[model samples]
Target: MAVKVAIFDWDGTLVDSVEHIADSLHQAATELGYPALERAAYRNIIGLGIEEALESLYPGITRADMQAMREGYGRYFFTKATTPREVFAGVTEMLADLRGAGLGRAVATGKSRRGLDKALVSSGLGVHFDITRCADETRSKPDPAMLGEILRFYRIEPDEAVMIGDTIYDMEMAQRIGMPAIGVEWGVHDQDTLAAFGPKAIVDSMADLRRALELL
Candidate 1:
C-alpha cells in the first residue's frame, strides 16, 4: 500500500533537544537528591514517557518523589535550560514536502501535552502536523497504543503509515502493529540499536529520509 501518513517522534527526531533533555534530567535528579546518571543513561530513556523514563532511571522511586522529579524536570526544561531547542536542519522542508505530497503529518512523542504545545508554537512546526499524540495522554512508546490511535484517527491501516523516529521505542511500537518504520541516526539510539527493531530503513539525513519514504 502507498504511504498516506508519516508519524514522527519529537525530541531528537525533529528537534535538537537531546542535550537539553539530558541536562534537564540531570538537574531534576540533583534537585531531588537522586543519584546522577551518565548522559547516555538519560539519553536512552528519551522515547519513554516522563514517568516511565523516571522509573527506568531511578528504580524504587515513590509516587510523591516521581511527581517532584517530573515537576523539577519541567521547570529546568522549560525555563532554566540554555540549550537551544531549534528544529533539526531540513525538518521544516521535509515536513513541507510531506504536506506537498498530501501525506498526513503527525507526532507520537513521549513529551507531555503541555511540553508539546509549547514546542509546537516555539518551533513553528505545529501547523504542519494533522494530529499529535503525547505520552502523558496515552501509552508511551514501545506499547503501540499511540501509533494505533494515530492509525485509527487517519483511518489507515498500519502499513499505510510509517513511523520515523530516532529510538528503539518508536521502532518497537510500530513493529508491534506490523507497521513500517524508518529510523533516523540523529536521535537517542544509534543505527545498530534502531536496526535491531527491523526498520525499513535507517537514514542519516533528511534528504535520505525523503528518498527512503519514496522507496517505501
Candidate 2:
C-alpha cells in the first residue's frame, strides 16, 4: 500500500534529547543510591519505556525502587536538567513537507504521555502531528500494540504507514506489524544496528529522510 501516514519515534529520532535523557537517568540513579552506569548504558535503553529502561539498567530492582527511580528521572528530566533538547535540524521543514504531501503525521514514542505532551509544547512541534501514542498509554517499543493503536486511529493498514525511528525496537515493531520503516542515523543506534532490522532506508539527515519518504 502507498503510505498514508508517517509515524515517528520521539527521543533520538526527531528530538536531540538522548544525552539529556542519559544525564537525567544517571541523576535519578544516583539520587536513589544506585550504582552509576556509563552514559552508553543509559543511551542503549533510550527507546524503551521508562519502567522498562530502568529495569534493564538496574536488574532485580525492587518495585519500590523502580517507582522512586521513575519519579526521580521525571523530576530531573523535566525540571532540574540544564541540557538543551531541541528538535533535530531541518525537522520542522521536513514535517512541513510531509504535511504538504497530504500525509498524516503521528508520534509513537517511548516517552510517557506527560513527557511527550510537554515536549510537544516546548518544541513547538505539536501542531504538526495529528495523533500521538506514549509508552505510558500503551505498550512500549518492540511490541506492535502502540503502532496498532495509531493505525486504528488513522483507519489505515499497517502497510499504509511508515515508522521512522532510530532504534531496532521501532523497526522491530513496525516489521512485526508489516509496516514499512525508515531509520535515522542520528539517534542512539548506529546505521548497521538499525539496518539489521530491515528499514526501507536509513537516513543520515532530515533532507535524506524527506527524499526517502518521497520515493516511498
TM-score of each: 0.97, 0.96
Candidate 2 lDDT over residue span 1-216, tens digit each: 269999999989888899989999999999999999988899999999988999999999999999999999888899832223477888888888888878999999999998988888888899999999999899988999999999999998998999999999999999999999999989999999988889999999888898898878
Question: Per-residue lDDT of 1-216 in model 1, one digit per residue for the tens?
Answer: 289999999999999899899999999998889988989999999989999999999999999999999999998999832222488888888899889889999999999999998888888899899999999899988899999899899999999999999999999999999999999999889999999999999999988999999998
Q: Candidate 1, after superposition: displacement of residue 7 in Å?
A: 0.3
The CA lDDT at 197 in model 2 is: 83
Off by over 4 Å in 2: 80-85
Q: Look at candidate 2 and give me any clashing residue pairs.
A: none
Local accuracy by lDDT, each model: 0.92, 0.90
Candidate 1's C-alpha runs over 4 A off are 80-85
Best by TM-score: 1
